[model samples]
Target: MKNFNWTNIRLFLIVGVAVFLYSFSGIRNEGRKIKQAEVVFVDNENFITKKDVNKLLKQNFDTVTGIKKVQLDLNKVEKSIDTNPMVDKAEVYATIDGKLTAIVVQKKPVARIFSGSKSYYLDYKGNEMPLSESETARVPLVSGSIDRTDKKRLSELLNYIYDDDFLKKNITGLAVMPWGDIMMDIRGYDFEVVFGKPINIDRKFKNYKAFLQDAIKDTLTENYKTINLKFTQQVVGTKK
Candidate 1:
């Protein structure tokens, strides 16, 4: 019985050793292939570039200065890239040929703001980004009290601007009042909208549209300083 038990133990050890050698050989072959393989594919739409990945790898691998190993934890690298504010999403993977690939998606900016001694851009998710001076002037400005509350208001206003095609083209600037009132300066019409309170905003916007349409059709020479829509049910225009 003792001899039988010893034989079983010896056989188990032999099997384990064989498995370990097989795995080790496979790993060594993989490493060699990875070292030899060049970048097979890069998803350009991904916010992160190949240069970014290379830079990150170099920075993180500096500790192993002399090592020629090219193995990478794709999940870890993708996580690092996704942390960037401009990157909406990122994915990393290795091809069958051992080439590393990364897919990145960039965040889209919805509106731009120039307030409090600095100009910034905001994404659709309301994240603020620093404005580049070299960027072309395309976004509308939000003037007035642009604090936390007003920031939210600005986002809402942008939604309205996107929905209304006429308003999108006609509006050139926005001025915020101390009491959270919004004043819009329309293009080419020589008139301003005194949008008091962000309440019933959609209704007030419709009213303004109706009034403008009527004025255009009638060809009336009514020079106005302010078109008040505080009470959306009632519109009052002050002549210049």
Candidate 2:
């Protein structure tokens, strides 16, 4: 029992010393001037470039490099980067070796909106993201009388469509009418889909899918000008 206690004490002392040395090294390195600044896109989605991030850092700190690691407000730096429309989130930190690093996650655009002369992207979370000149996202194009108030409802419908394989691949564009009716343009089809008022959404989609399968099987797809899903429990097809 005495030998075991001595062994345990020695092990605890060794661990304590190691931790103390590591902490001391970290404290000393915090005073060291930054040798380099690196912007790492965790998602590899470069909607905002590294140069843009460096420029932002410059605005915040006058200059990033040659500044002491201890002097940097990582929270401030992160907030500055996060304010960028392209960045979804940002984490800024200094490495032990005098390197300042910013990890950024770019927003994922699920749809592009064109309201009047202004155009922007709606990210997966339904937040409005200004279009980036650096990158273009291939997503559903939405036009017509859409306003900010309409986006939440529209985003729900868009998310549903995107989650479905057939809808994601086939539906390309959407037009919102002033009366809150939604019209969609489908791929490889002459018919327009009248998706009316974003209500009974899942049921409407199910009804549309059933209609589509039957129409294709019966060679009736080309006979329609508009496939309407506004009515509950049934699909209404207007003849061309």
Candidate 3:
């Protein structure tokens, strides 16, 4: 009975020692220093580069390398990258093998707005996006007396034009009048388009298409000075 009791006590001590050693090893691994970081853009666009993300990450940690894995505030690191105007979203994580990774998504600009001398891009979200030194987006340009409140409508209008291949290839510029009216310019055509208010977009576009198809079929596309779609149910073209 004495020998059996001793064996049970020895087994318990052995198990306890093994558990302590395992936990110690895990703790030590958690303290391992990060050796490198990699930034990946989901869209693969260079509007925001890896160097830019590295700078943003450094803003939080000075230098991310050589820091213990458990000491990094990943949420703060992600938030830092989110502050960039070009970034739409960002996610950051640390690997067990001492590598840090950040995945970034960038905003998409639909039109470049030129209000007076101030120029900026209007993104798909209807927000102003600053131009990048990396690359210029090949989007339509908007000019004239643009009201701040009209941004959402303008963005929608630009999106509609961009989605249609015919309109996207022909329409190059838009102008907002002081009285809240809109105008458009077509590529390779010497005519102005009276777009009017941004409502009834589908109907207006359909009417314009009918007019355009007839004008092209008749070989009189350049015979017009202005095409008006503001009138109800019809597109009015004024001969030059």
lDDT of 2: 0.88
lDDT of 1 at 198: 63
Candidate 3 regions with alpha-carbon error over 4 angstroms: 1-29
How displaced is residue 229 in candidate 3, in Å? 1.5
Per candidate, the number of residue pairs that clash is 2, 0, 0
Per-model TM-score versus the true fold? 0.65, 0.84, 0.82
Q: In model 2, what lDDT does residue 240 have?
A: 84
The CA lDDT of each predicted structure is: 0.65, 0.88, 0.88
Q: Tens-digit lDDT track for model 1 on 1-240?
A: 335688889999999999999999777755643432222223333334455545544555553223333456667777876676656666766654545555666655555676788777676567875554334435567767776345666677776775567777778787777777888888887778888766677898989888777777887426777788888787887888
Candidate with better TM-score, 1 vs 3: 3
> What C-alpha root-mean-square deviation, in Å, does candidate 1 show against the real structure?
6.6
Candidate ordering by TM-score (highest first): 2, 3, 1
**What does the lDDT read for residue 211 in candidate 3?**
89
lDDT of 2 by residue, 1-240 (tens): 335688889999999999999999888888899989998898856689999999988786778888888899898888999899998899988888878899889998878999888899988889999988888877889998886236678889988887788898899999988888999999999999999998789999999999999999999999999999999878999998
Q: What is the C-alpha RMSD of each candidate to the true structure, in Å?
A: 6.6, 3.5, 4.5
Q: Rate residue 42 of model 1 by lDDT.
A: 35
Give one digit per residue, the lDDT tens place, for model 3 in 159-240: 8987889998889898888888899999999999999988788889999998898999999988999999998578889989
lDDT of 3 at 106: 97
